[model samples]
Target: MEDTGIKIQPTMYGIFFEDINFAADGGLYAEMIKNRSFEFTLPKTGWLEPNSDRHSYNKESGILSIIKYSEEGANHNFARVEVNNDEGYVLINEGFRGMGVKEGAQYDFSVKAAKRSGDIQKIKLQVIDSLDNVLGATSITPDSDSWKTYESSFGVTKTEMKAKVKITFEGEGEIGLDMISLFPQDTWKGRKKGLRKDLVQLLDDMNPGFLRFPGGCIVEGRTLAGRYQWKKTVGDIENRESLINRWNTEFAHRPTPDYYQSFGIGFFEYFQLSEDMGAEPLPILGCGIACQFNTGELVPMDELDPYVQDALDLIEFANGDTSTAWGQVRAAMGHPESFNMKYIGIGNEQWGPAYIERYKVFEKAIKAKYPEIIIVSGSGPFPEGDYFEYGWEQLKQMNAEIVDEHYYKPPVWFREHADRYDSYDRNGPKVFAGEYAAQTMAIASPKNKNNWNAALSEAAFMTGLERNADVVYLSSYAPLMAHAEGWQWTPDMIWFNNLESFGTPNYQVQKMYATNSGTDLLKITEDGEKIIGKDGLYASAVKDVNTNELIIKVVNTLEIAQKLSISTEGSNSQQGNVGVLTMAMDNLEAENSFEQPMKISPKEGSATINEGRLEVEIPAQAFSIYKIKG
Candidate 1:
């Protein structure tokens, strides 16, 4: 290992979270009731009244109508039900593709209700299976004429994956309901209405360096009016307002019209989560421009104050003292201490002159107000050509701190571009390899799979990223997760369903890199040159001062085993037994599934060093990490 004296940034290996697929409302947020507030474009998108035909509102047990409290305000709509007969007047919620409940687990149920007319005494909430068998049941009695929240909990007797919540009203009468919510009692940290336990545990296990949230193209919506606004995603969950998810129609292959952002897990939760996981909070915001791939809508240059102001307010919200306005808002939500956010991104994959113009305004405003806060700019979507060149040149001239770059290419591209950043300007704006993934098929194609080929290639490419840790401050895999049954994009790092989740081979690669991310960068070369896919081998080395150990990552992408002898340079300390963690697969198409999550998981082994040199045989298509203590 050649000592380079370069310090690796602590924020190097991070996770990029975009609410694509059924990630949030369905997958992560732990909210089992869909369209809880009745605010979707179609108010009853996830609700069904089997006995009553909506076309004629014909005679049935009950007829439900959506009522708007006001033309304005976040929580505008609620369900008003008129019950004719109490026998079968039932309302069922099809949770994000059905809820997953476990036996012996307590499920919490809550709703805001008020009796509008005759004797509606009790509300019964039941967790029922596909055959309509009740798995768990709870009831709440509403004793108030005014809107008040009623809550109850019950333990399920049977574990069911495709469970649906059934609501029945006792005694025929008129009633109003809003914010009908259900969550597993056993959530992450045991907080009520918190994130999914299993899903979050997977993320925490990685020890990610940072969490980039609430986004992808969602930050820049299809139109300016629909762009993600941080202010709307905080405070009371009841008032957090839902917006139609941009991924609802982003891909034609996977049309999810019911997808929307409930914001149950909003900005405050993001900061809290980052704090919980010891990851830096990296929030990327819109720059008054819509998604260029869509409408490319722009908010008039003169009216970009609100956009610029959002950036400044976000900094205050994250770092300001309790006495400040935005900080006070944050404190009201239960956190008084600052979140200590250090990075703010201006835009997401935006490009051209319009993005630069808006970014300039945000940069100027942010630096003037909070100079210590690092601003992360964008260089459009393309990794090369005129757009990249122009954006880089402009940001470099403006002295932009970090520029986020995204790439979703084939496995071959990943192997070929292992040294993509080797020649980056030493004096220019630093890079945030913000979003990247090895696509097994075409980019954004529905046919892609998270197989060993893609992951192996990514491991090979990441060597360059680690080697150039000085210029690349942060790196994270894009579209971090996907719902196996409801994904718009393909080849995600992690995939999940209603009942279970499994890390793909790509996820294993990321975990290996992130968990062993060292403190100091060291050069690992062959014949006086960096190993960028030499003999189907790629490697990088680093020293972890905190652990008092040297870590070397090597990837072998061949059909047969290869032997490597790595020698320590300029050190007389004799090496002892070297620990090894290896993840290998002979088949490129091999992948991990819910049935076998550890199909490609790391296996621990050992090697020995002779005369300050460590010799190891790396299996074909394997990613290995060798650790030697000084």
Candidate 2:
């Protein structure tokens, strides 16, 4: 492998973040309770009142009810408990399938309360097991007449993933409680109010180039009225309104009625996360069209101005000066400067003449206001066929900067289609493989998998994406995460429950390519031609300008090892000790588990170059990266 002299763009390997499969509220938001603000449609979805059993036996036990304030603001609802005695009338918070607690780890418990009447003397907070045994306990005595904040801390003696937060009042009295919150002190970067440390660390390890967020179909809800409105996702957490997630019902696997967006990890947090991870921020907004999979509703062209305006306002919010209105809001959120966003997308998996009409309006408005901002247009869900071809044709005519494409096919489809982008026109709108993963069963099937077969196939396809770096500018795996028990979709890149998280073999493949991505593309050929599934091997080459190293990736989706002869043409002074990282599994279905997350992960080794060329053996069912020093 040697330098072909083609330059790979900095935004080649990135991430796509969507709020599906409990990825936001129950997974990444760091809040233990499911509906902490009592904002769900049921208002009591995640809460369980044990008063039915105990109150019947003793009338002294209290009854809990909800109170709703004026609906003008976000924190419009709170829970009210009327207690007659300390007979243990309980309010239990069934966390996202129960909170994950660790032994010797401290947790912070806080609440907002006011004493309206009665001797409501104390409020005790305890983390209890399924048998009602207390794991850790902390109490707060609220003697104030107006709403004020209360805080306390406790440490568990044992680790448990099915732990619940219990609240019991002492003495007879009337109390108002809102925002009963609990957070693990050990968050990512140890920020007081932060993301799940383990989950963020996995993303940080990838060294992603950019982060495209607020996504999938959530940006375009089933109805235009229910779309993800970024205006409502910024500012104070308590003030950020909650909405029903479009994926709340009728999923391919599990249907979650209690699913709602608290916006705890909102747009502001997304930009901050991108900054923390040292990646560019790419935000997608609605374009007046609802999800085509559902309603396929469209806002009349005459009334599409607001949707276009949202895109303009977002660019201002991300890269505006403090003197501007939206920039003032960004500054008040503690980031006085800017997110420095470079790309803005109009729709997700959208196409057709209607999409083109709306996209044209958005393009003119966005470019008229901010010419330097790159506009990412959309291609329909399927990566090929009439709609995809039509989108590319129309977008290219419009001189669109980038076009987003997505596909989820069988593992064989990936390996066989390694040259999917080879025929793409070099002068057309560049590609953004925005949402893609090799499906083992079917699209979003509960039985689908994140097995080694899918990973290796993806690696095979990625070589083609890299080989066409001039046209394919950005790529990412779809639906980045899922919760084991509460997930609606399978085959996610990262899997987690309440306590622990692990990356699948697919995730390892993504991380390897992203972290090892070089600055320039090179030619790695056998028989003086590009390698594409010949001998069950796929290969691509690149050069890292910063490190002065030439990198080559090889995927062997075969049952036997393949030996390659040395021939680098060493005329360009490309030579050195070859460092190889190989990821292989005995079985195609072999998976990474919580106990052994890296079971099928990459393994590093050194290979001495013979003379001027590097000779190596690629193992069966493996994806390997060779870093050659220059």
Candidate 3:
């Protein structure tokens, strides 16, 4: 191994989080109650009155009506529920494909309610299985005439994956309800309204370097009106208006019309999440252009000021002092300190002359104000095309600091293109392989699987990314997590059902690289040339200055085991045994399910260094990392 004198950036291996595949509402965000604010297009989409007779309205046991606010606002609708004959008048909230609850786990439930008419004494909430067995129960009395917030907590008797919240009214009267929500008390950091513990734990375990947020096509919605607005995603949760997710109707085969962005886990939460993971917050903003794949709508050049202003305000919110307008808003939200954000992406996968025009406006405004913030520009959606060529050429001329590139190609493409960035201009803008995945099938195909073949190939390709760490400043896989049943996209990094979640083979590969990503680059070569799938092996080497350790990553793509000796050049005799982490699968079709999450995970082994040379036998179809400590 020869020292390359190239420093690997701290923001090298990071995360790309988009709300597709119910990742936010149903997966990461721990809120169990869906349609919490009754703001969805179909306000009662997740609610059902099992016993009420629709034809008999108020004549039955009870009836529910969606009342819109006279003065239009974000919290536009409230449920006016009237109880006639209080005989099992139950309102059931079918959670995001049913709530996942563990036995003996406490869940906090809250709701805003007002006694509209007669004596609606109290509201009883219970967690019940599909068979109507109540596992947990809590109640709150509604004694106020004006809006009042009630909170209660209860513990479930048994672990249930498909438990639904059954709400019942006591006494015969009417009440207005809004923002009815439920969350597990054992959330990440025990925050009342917080993220899922297990899911966040998985992300934290990776020790990611940076977090790219609210993104992919989400920044540019299907139409200009639906694009993600950082302003709308901040402030009070009640006022953060919900929007139909751009992925809601993108795919016809796996339609997710119910998908929507509640913005509960908004921009502020994204920054907090980055802080929690010790990751640099990289928030991508809208550039006054809708997704080119859809409408390709553009905000007239003269009218692009609002979009540019959002980017400027966001920087202030993230790093400005409390005296500033946006900074004060961030402080009032419980975080007085700045998030210390350093990177901002102007657009997401947008291209053409129109994209360049809008990006120019944003660039000018942002550089004029927050000149220190490094701006990330896009190079279209695909890696190669007329639009991609034009976008790269124009961006190169503009002297952009960083340019984002995306590609979702077949597994073979990944293995063959290990030198994808070898020819990149050393003086040009740094590259961010923002969105990439090895597709076993076609891109976004429902048939795609997160199999060993794809993961192994990606591992082979990542060596190239690390090899060119000087130019490739940042890299992350797309569509991070997915709800097994509620997902529109396939082959996601992590898959979770209502009650359980498991990292895919792809996730295992990412974790391996991220956890061992060293500080400085080193050359691991054969005959003084870099190894790029020579004799079925691909490798990269790095040294962690902090740990005083050398990390060598090798991937064997062949169907047979390979033997090799790595000689540490110009080094004193090592004192400790080499730590070996092997993740191998002879079956390329192998995958990880909830039942076998660690099926494809790394297995710990050891090796000894003799005469400044480490001898090891690499398994077939595997990715291994050998850590040598001084």
Q: What is the lDDT of residue 178 in candidate 1?
A: 96
After superposition, candidate 3 runs with Cα above 4 Å error:
573-576
TM-score of each: 0.99, 0.97, 0.99
- What root-mean-square deviation over C-alphas does model 2 reach? 1.6
Instruction: Encode model 1's per-residue lDDT on 1-630: one tens digit a residue.
Output: 777988999899998998998888888899999999999999999999887877774757889899999978899999999888975798999998888899999988999998999988889999999999999999999998899999998999998889999999888889999999999989999999999998999999999999999878989999988889999999999988789998898887899999999999999999999999999999999999999999999999999998888888999999999999999999999999999999999999888999899899898888888889999999988788888889999999999999999888999999999899889998889999988988887889999999999999999999989999989999998888888778999888888998899898888899999999999998888999899888999999999989888899999998999998888775443669899999999889999998999999899999998788988999998999999987
Tens-place lDDT per residue, model 2, 478-570, is 889998887887789999989889999999999999998999888888888889999898999888889977788999888998887656565
Residue 432, candidate 3: Cα error in Å is 0.4
lDDT of 3 at 283: 98
- Per residue, candidate 3 scores C-alpha lDDT tens digits across 1-630 of 777899999999999999999999998899999999888899999999998887774557888899998556788899999888774688999999988889999999999999988888889999999999999999999989899899998899999999999999889888999999999999899887899988999899989999999879989999999999889888999899999999988999988878898999999999999999999999999888888889989899988888888889999999988999999999999999989999999999998999898899899989999889999999998988898899999999999999999999999999999999999999999999999999888998999999999999999999999999999999999879999889998879999998888889899899999999999998888997889989999999999999989999999999999998989976553555999999999899999998899999999999999878998999999999999985
Worst 10 residues of 1 by lDDT: 566-575
